[model samples]
Target: MSAMTGELAMCGASVETLFEESVEPVVELVLGGQSARVALFGATVISWRTGARDRLWMSSLSARDGSAPIRGGVPIAFPQFADQGPLTLHGFARTARWRLADRKANLDGTLVEARFVLARSAIADTQGWVGDFELRYTVRLGVRRLELELQVANLGSAPFDFTACLHTYLLLDDVRNVTLHGLSGLEYFDKVAGRDRDEVNDAIRVEAASHSSGDVLGQRAEGFVDRIYRAGGERSPLTLQHAASGETYSIAQSGFPDTIVFNPWVAGKKGTKGPDFDDDGYNHMICVEPAITREGSGPIRVSPGSTWAGTQTIQVL
Candidate 1:
């Protein structure tokens, strides 16, 4: 591990690298009363704190020794999403070690930025996928907002098609007390039911009943939920509001055409939890992911020497 630290004399913003004995290095960014932690193992933002509260939820059983993918925070899904392709689940970017390309703070120190790079060589195996590629991930932290941008550049001579996403887990007072706005009138593919359906309500609430019944307006979400909403070329921001705390988060994405909402309400047959998730974890966290692939739509193609990028910005409102 490199013994390095960056400081800004103008303000309270600073970037420091901490090394653990066996695990990868972790980068900490602090500005004013807000802070964020990034682990190089997957270039994953494991923690983000603002207003003295943690807005990102992390699973208590998540592995910290780079043994497995961290269960929470903003995990980068690249080259493939889930079992959509022949590659591993969510691709290898979430588990592969990333290189810290750069880190710095602005002149006033009100914002901090860090860049991580992953090349084709870093990936041990690409599952027979051809095409040399490089990924650049940038994280910007402000007092009340966090921005994540992913750039995929094709360096090979041939064009390649792939899918990607920013899997973000948001912590909430209670998943049932929250309503997600801005997905109204759109169509979504429900993974749990393996069907396509239309969203009728302007505000989407967690419901225990199946949404296929057309009467999911006021119900609470209790069962396992996994749906991908198509938002092609739409720039409208989605808002997640916690009823108990009055805390609202505005989630917006660019270059990512789909949004996936997921929650494992009941883990197993009897609501038993998985190894990396708590029995009650579903009650406190929800994932509103920004993705680049749509149902029945194929992967995105990038020409030689061309680059594809996506940005997801979350703000406290």
Candidate 2:
């Protein structure tokens, strides 16, 4: 059997092997003038660049030894999110190694796709969970757009539930100059205040009260901001403006009901901690996660022989 599978390109899209010395093999994908770097360790996309700028960010101090989850890029949170379940912090998917199941570049070379698979049979401890399950993660990189999809299928006779999220850290020229639009009047649970509130911000609004969206969801001049906003059936496009760069990015989601906006501005202040990030790094990246993290009401349940899937797309504008 072949140890891995790979394909060539026609126009410009191609998948190349990379980072052979790391704990897990890395794959470098190029589509037209845009390119991305993904590691098989967690099937994580660690870097994305178009032209002269990077769209994704990875912390300098991130643990690359595979002992802990890397502190940046797009980390796949599966089975459970946070400490809400019996599993570890963000589940095992982020740290567990994944297998490259398929790779292909379209004949036209306008797009490239890579598929990775993870199964219980591939894990050693199973993390105290039992069942026959397979998680399929697919990344489709096009010339101007990036699409990410996660599919979970149950192979056993019993039903199972899982909460998942694509924790995406977007690199920015300056966090203070960035703005997230189209999140008005939505509800959110403030992790710091431990309460639920409404988002009334219009243009990156930051209020005296933490966790509540005023008229906008903008970065503050100082301090940290972390909140989980609930987007209930609201599929309006979310846009992020990188003011300094004079560029804007649009985000859209399907099968994902909630969105998480977080930025730990300064380390070692107000109970904030970032062991893997540089103190000044907070001003360069922001996390916007598409997640379903409800305690018992939000998990995606897959019946025996059934499957559940979700997709999120990011585009540069």
Q: Write the per-residue lDDT of candidate 2 for residues 1-317, one digit (tens) a residue.
A: 12222345545567776665555678788887888888887888888888657888888878777878888889999888877788888888888888888888777877788888998777776688765789998988886778889988999999987888898998887777888888778777766555687777865522233334333333332444666777632644688887777887888877777887777764322223557776667778888888888731287778999988878788997
For model 1, give the 10-residue run with minimal summed lDDT: 212-221
**104-135 per-residue lDDT for model 1 (tens digits):** 77877678888999999999988888868999
Best by lDDT: 1
Model 1 Cα displacement at 192 (Å)? 0.7
Q: Which ten residues in a row have the lowest lDDT in candidate 2?
A: 205-214
Report backbone clashes per prediction: 4, 12
- In candidate 1, list every pair of residues with a backbone clash: 206-220, 206-221, 207-220, 207-221
What candidate 1 gets wrong by more than 4 Å, as runs, is: 1-9, 210-222, 232-235, 268-274, 294-297
Structural similarity to truth (TM-score) of each candidate: 0.91, 0.89
